[model samples]
Target: MRYERVYVIWDLYDGVRTGVADLDGTPHYFASQYDEGPDDYSDNFKLYPVGTEFMRRAARNWNIYRAWERKFHNGETDLKTHPGHGGIDAEYDELRSWLDKQVVLLEALPSLYRAKFRELPNQEGLPGGMLRELEVTWSPSPV
Candidate 1:
């Protein structure tokens, strides 16, 4: 049997918002496992729960920011600012908090588990130097 594990890395802005989600809520840039059946996979297949949570939070924030940006730019809001009428500082703070939480979660992962969180190499001009990739590898337990 072969097992499959998925890893997802997200680009966050200043700590609060998610720039993107890998694919339709799936976070794996690269995923592979040896066993095909669930029986062959480890019991802890979904070990990175926090990472998933982080992505969800980031996605939500990103959507909110995008909406705000649109409204502000389109003159739909009474605020006056380059991105919005006001609350720019507040948004930045929110984004920063989100990013900080993400870091905490990443750092909390066990060293053994870090390999499973692999971050894909950045091809875009975007900065991703602060993010760490976790690589996941699976092997059968020794007899």
Candidate 2:
């Protein structure tokens, strides 16, 4: 079977928020930058239960963000909460590190699994230079 693991990366003003969730995905996986059409861009990095309780709590937080995301399914609503809004929420660091671990796992995915994520289309008009905000996609084993 073909499966594509997806992680939504939030390039917020302070830092990045990336997450992975394999709800019902198979062990095979891949990770890559998210590509979306001009008209469709709605998907957050879902988080599965696979880490310390703190990590799980963070995953659940992403879930809550997603629920808020659904209210504006058209992708017009912005779910990002800035640190400046209140002295940079300390959780940013914790979440970032946790998310990085997930990236490490994606890098280890076999070539075939990696290809599934590379199958993204509509990759035009992507500006050059350092990218602060980007969504990463990758699949992982089913638990």
Every candidate's lDDT: 0.39, 0.38
lDDT of 1 by residue, 26-74 (tens): 3522212224565343222222234566666655655565555555555
TM agreement with the true structure for every prediction: 0.33, 0.33
Query: Tens digit of lDDT per residue, candidate 2, span 30-115?
Result: 22234376443223233334445434555554554444445334354443643323333456455656655664554332321122
Candidate 1 has a TM-score of 0.33
| Candidate 2 minimal-lDDT segment of 10 residues | 110-119
